[model samples]
Target: MNKKLIIGMILGAILGIFCILGARLRLPDHASFSYLLSFWYNRVILGVIIGLLPSLKSLKLSLLRGLLVGVFVSFAFYSATGFLDLMGFFAGFVYGVIIEFVLFKLNQMEKL
Candidate 1:
């Protein structure tokens, strides 16, 4: 298995778990079992996408790449939910940066 892939998946799962918890708190009345499950799946897919992206020479470029990907990937869910969750859409951008930053650091550490 690819190291980046594994790292991305783990990070994705962790972030997804957090998102689930947060959603539960925020929409306790509206959240259904299937909705939360799919939401978490979306984050996992983001991680997989992040893991598969080729490494960039510039750190800024790498992070930016992630950010873009995040927004793109997150848009699917946002629109699916009828654009009701603006925060979730924006959070995708943050998650993208965080995932990229972590991947960058891990790769850097590997070289040490």
Candidate 2:
């Protein structure tokens, strides 16, 4: 894998672990699994940022491509966490799509 992708994966995993740990510590003892999963969901934003960093040098990929890559990265990282399952994977994918859409809009505005 390219350095950028490797870096993205490492960063995503670190952030995901930290997020999960924080949630477990701060939430009430009776917190639902879904409530804890919410913390993992937020890590998708970090995945999105990592996705955008490598692409800043060239906007050659279409927005769809960027979103796909972002989702893939997020899923891969989330898979490392024993607590996350399929639902968390899907949520991360959706978060990636939203992040890519926002980034696309911002990039367009910057060019104008």
Candidate 3:
């Protein structure tokens, strides 16, 4: 197993747990944060995939993967809060794309 992937997963999980705790504590809800939490977690998970699998580096492939996870998270949030959060779904995609692009740039720099 790749160590970077393992570390990314652990870090993502920790971030997710902290997000939940923070939300429960009423310390600025998810909306108040402008879906950054959702964006970050989505990025972390997808970024790990990008790091581990080169095939997922394409923008189309990354967006598909991000959409799948984002919609799922949105649905989960709706179920838990009884309110749909489409912004989170969109933010997830944005962040996932951002991470992929950044990864692409880093790989390019590695070749230089």
Greater lDDT among 2 and 3 belongs to 2
Pairs with steric clashes in candidate 3: none
State the RMSD for candidate 1. 1.5
Candidate 2 — which residues are off by over 4 angstroms?
A: 1-61
TM-score of 3: 0.46
Candidates 1 and 2: which is better by lDDT? Answer: 1
Q: What would you estimate as the lDDT of candidate 2?
A: 0.53
The TM-score, computed over Cα atoms with residue i paired to residue i, of candidate 2 is: 0.45
Better of 1 and 3 by TM-score: 1
Most TM-score-accurate candidate: 1
With candidate 3 superimposed using the best TM-score fit, by how many Å does residue 68's alpha carbon deviate from the native? 6.5
- Report the C-alpha lDDT of model 2 over 1-112, residue by residue, as the tens digit: 5444444444555556665665566544733687556555556445535544644534545355556765666666556555445555554555455444545455566631
User: At residue 70, what lDDT does model 1 achieve?
Assistant: 92
lDDT of 3 by residue, 2-111 (tens): 64455445544554554455454543454445454653464466546544655344667655654565455445544554555444445445544454455445545552
> Candidates ranked by lDDT, best first?
1, 2, 3
lDDT of 1 by residue, 1-112 (tens): 6899888988888998888898888888767998788778888989989998876667899899889989998899889988877877887888988999889888787931
* Better TM-score candidate (1, 2): 1
Query: In order, what is each prediction's RMSD in angstroms?
Result: 1.5, 7.8, 6.4
Candidate 2's displacement at residue 64, Å, is: 2.1
The residue pairs that clash in candidate 1, if any, are: none
- Which residue segments of model 1 deviate by more than 4 Å? none
